[model samples]
Target: MFLLQVDEEIQIKLLMPKDATALTTVLCANQEHLKTWLPWAVEIPSVSTYEKEIIPSWLQKFADNNGFEAGIFYKNKLVGMAGLHYIDWRNKTTELGY
Candidate 1:
């Protein structure tokens, strides 16, 4: 897991299953504001969704090195996530999705 410190109160690190509840909190809290830009914004209903589906899939992709998802923490709380999806090794290209 990569840990980066942006400032005294902000940090960035890989998102893990253990962070499900926190991630869910961030998502739920910003759902209305995020819904316009994020298609999956309304899909997360609870931590179970993270435990059973979301986190698992993200982990798989990270393991494969195809891409990964990271959490943006502010004051020790998850505030958002940034996803790096589908690295095209041959072309050396990838897109950062947030």
Candidate 2:
């Protein structure tokens, strides 16, 4: 339940399972625009696909402290997502994905 305020109207919060549909809609609406930065946008088959599979995996990784996926909220609407992928503990590093 972490939350970061980016501004008066923008905030960052962990993406929860319940947010799947909203996130999916955002993704679908911005698919073409997002593809340039996120190749995986084209791979999503449907909204349910993310709700049932992808989001669960993200939550698990967050709980495990191996990674995190947070949603970018603007005016209470899910606009995008950002995250850090598998951390290399020995190297004390991780890759940020948004």
Candidate 3:
């Protein structure tokens, strides 16, 4: 897994299938707030969606060297997610999404 340590209380890493439940819970709790910024957040997804679809797709993206979606952890708890939508190798750029 890709991991990055931002500080004592913050960490970021590629999310695995096992993290589905925790991610689902965090999204559920923050759905209303997230909806304002993320159109897809208008409806919270099920843990199964994360496990079977989202996370798998993200892993594939990483494997293909395109980009990645990762979990944001604070104080050992999952708080949010971040990602690079895609990488433009020729342009040497990527779009950050959170």
Candidate 4:
């Protein structure tokens, strides 16, 4: 479930495909913002890449009964992403790599 919360600052509760468009908007606009040192930075921010790869990766983790992909919001704006990657469902915890 994709959810957004607002308080002192916006806090994204979950991530979903619907949030992709907005997140990409922020990522693309700020592409160069993290390019200098972030080697994994995309040459160009594309929704297809986010959809085709990211979504599937998240689904796979979930199908395996673990982890999730989520976005980060700041003051109601899509700012970044955060989520559990490989989770230990038995322990009620997951590996979050953002």
For model 2 the local lDDT of residue 11 reads 94
lDDT of each: 0.85, 0.84, 0.94, 0.70
True-vs-predicted CA distance for residue 49, candidate 4, Å: 2.7
Q: What TM-score would every model get versus the actual structure? A: 0.86, 0.87, 0.92, 0.62
Give the residue spans of candidate 3 off by over 4 A.
none
Report the alpha-carbon TM-score of model 1 versus the true structure: 0.86
Q: Is candidate 1 or candidate 2 better by lDDT?
A: 1
After aligning candidate 1 to the native by TM-score, how far in Å is the CA of 57 from where it should be?
1.9
Per-residue CA lDDT of candidate 3, range 1-98, in tens?
79999999999999999999999899888888989998999988889999999999999999999999999999989998899989999999999999
Clashing pairs in 4: none
- Candidate 4 overall Cα lDDT vs. reference? 0.70
**Candidate 2 residue lDDT tens string, 7-51:** 999999998778888987887788888888777777655667777
Q: Tens-digit lDDT track for model 4 on 1-98?
A: 54656568978666565666786777778778767756667575468767677766776765666776777778767777787767765778766666
The lDDT leader among the candidates is 3
Query: Model 1: clashing residue pairs?
Result: none
lDDT of 1 by residue, 1-98 (tens): 67889999999888877899888887888889888887878676689878788888988888899998888999988888787888999999999987
Name the 10 consecutive residues with the lowest summed lDDT in model 2. 41-50
Measured with C-alpha atoms, the lDDT of residue 80 in candidate 1 is 80
